[model samples]
Target: MTDGDDMKNGSGPAAHSGWRGGHAPRWGTAACVAAVAALLAGLPWAAHGRLPGRLATHWSGGAAPDGSMPLWAAAVFPAGIWLLIALVVSLSRRRARAGARPWRGLVLAPTGTVLVGAQASVVRANLDRTDWHEARQPVWAIVLILALTGAALAVAWRIAVHVASATPAIAPPELDLPEGERLAWFSHAANPWLQLLSAAACLVATGTLVALGVGLASPEALWPVFAVCGVIALASGVFSSVRAKVSEAGLEVAFGPLGWPARRWSPAAIESARAEQRRPSEVGGWGYRLSGHGTTVMLRAGDCLVVRPRGRRSDFAVSVDDAERGAALLNALRRRDRAGIG
Candidate 1:
């Protein structure tokens, strides 16, 4: 394919340079992934040779075994994700231009980390036990979650530092809002198309998980579904109905009735609050994204009120209309709070 075609498809010779964002090289990543896959694939046999014909993949505290996988299936499960990650990273590398943001590796870390943890968990679960009734999965779920969180935080911090440091800190124009006066702004937005997409994806995932969990899928397999479901449900709800508020309590953002995954920024905590133009694609797609700029909650790109908190790396950016007004009010509040605190 032509370089243009490769760039359009996001996979070309330039994409494999592996020099973006100070992360490991693409070849190095491929090698590491291969090593992990090999180690995981061999673990079931290396750790314990001559296992039972049918091993326990999952367990339940019940009269009968809930889930089981062929020993080979259990062994290969961890290495299996390597293929997916490699494909994605490969595509990401191909698609990216040589000088573009180094997001490809960061984006793959969470998934790769989770998959590696999963492989280790599965391998450990099936070892040294004749019984298939107890859930032997290692503490992989926590590891996976932590790994994902850590990757996100790392990427956010990198972006924050890069963007914030690069940004010139000229004093914002003053706005008149007294300390006694409660400055508050509220806005609500919903994207029907995104919500519909979420609903469809979640429905399919929920159905798949149900089948796997109940229809003899192992506990090792089912545990991750809970996490996946949580993510999907949260995304589906949050993207559809977004509520943004700026007040004395700082900047507050919530979604839907559950109102989970909410964020509140105190005036004292903010280093800078300003309006900036945001393009959704830069952050690698919308709805809770991370990129060279920072972490963003983008729903229809345009103006965003980006906040850089004190002593933190990632700048919190949310897309909203009339971002300038909100930013001005935020600065006024911050100055007021800074004065009061002093």
Candidate 2:
């Protein structure tokens, strides 16, 4: 049987037999419901006034009522507290699993914090009806949100370290290959760093442009900025779509927006290709990336195929659905090239 078939039958280590039959966790469902209830309860607070303390005043537009917190603050405070509580509950549940480690929770905490902080900021921004340029309210709100976000991240990192200490270490599988194929196999591994750098650069550039007042400062200008960001994000998606296809003609790469433009390369130009495992973080969290070492195409996590050019030392890696099959096809093409046969 083909390796793919073996995987489907759960004979392979990567096979997921429980995917279809698995039941949803009751605790997770309960936590989500509770969070939603908390958010709903806070809606009245968010609609009318400001919160307490320095953050409360900063977040509340100066129009906040005397001696009373803003509705927006009331809503956000409860939601934030609920979020923290839910996270703690979820982490406890995860810890109950056999060999479960606290480190996983720690790693994910920052992401949760950022999400909540961003949500709160967005809600506050929407609540205030003032124009961005005239009121200059959003700028201060953004700063406050960022400060809170930073604090949350610091706490998350500390939590992650503690969790990592308690978690059991699992040994990675040994990749066995024929002696002559070792180099070929290694080249196919996907690296995610390239895509992450690209995304980070895009964010930095856009933020810089906004800060420099290059774009319209009015809230209406926000749409155009968002559109530009969308275009950048789409570029990566198009690249990923192209990387997934493998056929007898050669490898087809998607290049343009909506994959309108494509590039085709013959097997003759492909020196070596192989499959490799990739973690979500290592591969730029799933998108197209061009690294200093080589190009990386990824869309989600799992196995990837790395292809090297015939005379070049550097290799390009792409995440694909059937990486092993793609690697086999590349190997066949390489053999054909060596024999001077198509």
Candidate 3:
């Protein structure tokens, strides 16, 4: 009813501003430091010939002489040093933020570059080695594992920073709709059919990849199978998009590959459209969907509308930001259409 009410309802534009701040958390820094400390402490075991079977073997050559570092030292030393540097950076950032930090987003570049460089170094250094077995176990395996772990940690740290950053205290403005008109908030996400179709496509794609990797399926077969699955997913996504763009005289729908193409429907052939809220479970996950009831398109979030064509049992729904407002707009447009008002 009022601007204050609109803000309270989260319809104001100022509510969703970007986050601010730049720093990692203390716990993450501490964990990294601890891991480094463990690695350094274990160096002594390698020096004293007490290294475990897993560690004793080197990919480039047999273990270095008792007092000498193995060839893999080129890879390990740099990785360790970079990791330590990252730990220090994280710690300093944490302290600087005083427990609240914005997301810098810069840490990703340096960390990612260093890790990629380290891997390249290891691969290049071991390329000429005759013993393939030695190359496989500790050197490649450890490098791979560490690289993946570091990447994951970096991502997690970034997410934490984003979460900790200050957010703008603003909200979206509400839309004004006329009275006496029935409003519908249609959301494709309310439809279960589209979701199931999307999920099935994903599963099939994943299974195909797995089958190909394990040599259970031919590569040639994999491509066609995935291509088909992709098409199916695309179709469902299109159906969902189209369902979200309904109007009085006709509904404009988006579908297919890029989800860019649109479809228009006439109101005379039309049915009824009304707004309704769908529980998260009812939609079968968020986004465009197709259920037994029909296809629903969810573009933003919140409540949606269900539209049933006249004499047609199938209902198409679409989720939007403000269902009541959208319905009002549509109804107004419909009235204009009926009166020959553009």
Candidate 4:
């Protein structure tokens, strides 16, 4: 499930196999993104003659329309949003060149389908109507669109998996350890921007809580703000920094400054370990990320310690300094354990 490439064909352990799929997947994804954007942009114009001057773009629970936009705006607005999403998703996919990022397809396919469907629905609802208010909510159309979105997601996911499976898996080489010698490696990484973000969120949460307590604002409104800020603060604080260590006991990865929550794997439990260069975009942004690449504790871009656990197909990665040495040390320790050495 790693977004990181398995390995490129070369002589060293650092390089394994080549990507036989070549640039086809990349070009295909770009084409699909462009097609979806075009479809969204074209849907409104296709039925422009029968549609009203203003479209009912938003609706409340009732049948009447609550928000209206000019016909030109309606066509451009959703298309603009779709393009923005496509840009972000495409950049992430491009960053993950080594493996098939199913997460990208999963996100883009459903989102594009929904946007296109919604645009079509809006056109159908406003067809032959004189005023935006005269339009009724497309309840059945919405339901059907949602169902189609699910189908699109399933198809995209299957395609991504098939593409990823085509990439061959590479085995990392075990480092050689000298006789009667103990070895250990340690590395730490942190992002100051994430720390600042967490602090800002905490400050906002505190202010909102105080406002709620002092009756400075409505309890219901302030409560939601407070809750959102609190959650952001907690998550950002926890993943802002990481410490990784490799020893005879295997690899230990600790999260946050306090380091109460950590993950450890025994030498025997690890099948392979390697250091890879990975970016936040490749794994779906900073902090803890779970994508086709498995699970990644991404604090900052650059070197990462990637470990494949025994009996698992996916790899777990953590961003840290000197990850290559750390990985080599871990592999060496695993080999030592396998050799029954003290």
The estimated TM-scores of all candidates read 0.42, 0.35, 0.36, 0.47
- Candidate 1: which pairs clash? 10-94, 10-95, 11-94, 11-95, 12-94, 58-219
Greater TM-score among 3 and 4 belongs to: 4
**Which candidate ranks first by lDDT, i.e. highest?**
4
* Candidate 3 runs further than 4 Å off: 1-128, 131-270, 280-292, 297-302, 309-311
For model 1, how does the per-residue alpha-carbon lDDT over 125-217 read when each residue is reduced to its tens digit?
A: 555556655445445454655875587558644643432222222222333564354545544444555565554455445444433422334
- Residue-level lDDT of model 3, residues 200-302, one tens digit each, is 6744664454344333446997989988987776666455322234334356554522335654556654566667777546666555567765766654345
Model 3: worst 10 consecutive residues (lDDT sum): 15-24
After superposition, the stretches of candidate 2 with alpha carbons farther than 4 Å from their true spots are 1-233, 236-243, 255-258
C-alpha RMSD for every candidate: 17.4, 14.0, 12.0, 17.0
User: In candidate 4, residue 126 scores what lDDT?
Assistant: 83
Model 4: per-residue Cα lDDT over 1-105, one tens digit each: 221112222223321222222343455456566666666666667667767888998888789989999888998899899889988877877687656465587
lDDT of each: 0.58, 0.46, 0.45, 0.73
Ranking by lDDT: 4, 1, 2, 3
Per-residue CA lDDT of model 2 for 1-342, tens digit only, reads 001111112222221011111122243235433544443344344444322221232334454322223455545665666567656766685667633433444434444444444445433443444432222235665575577567756765664453333222222222222323321111112123333333444443334333223222354656566566656645543443332334445565544223336555677888788888775577555555666537666654676777887788877776655677667755765665567563
Lowest-scoring 10 consecutive residues by lDDT in candidate 1?
A: 1-10
- Name the lDDT of candidate 4: 0.73
Model 4 steric clash pairs: 1-292, 1-293, 1-294, 2-293, 3-293, 9-17
TM-score of 2: 0.35
For model 1, the local distance difference test gives 0.58
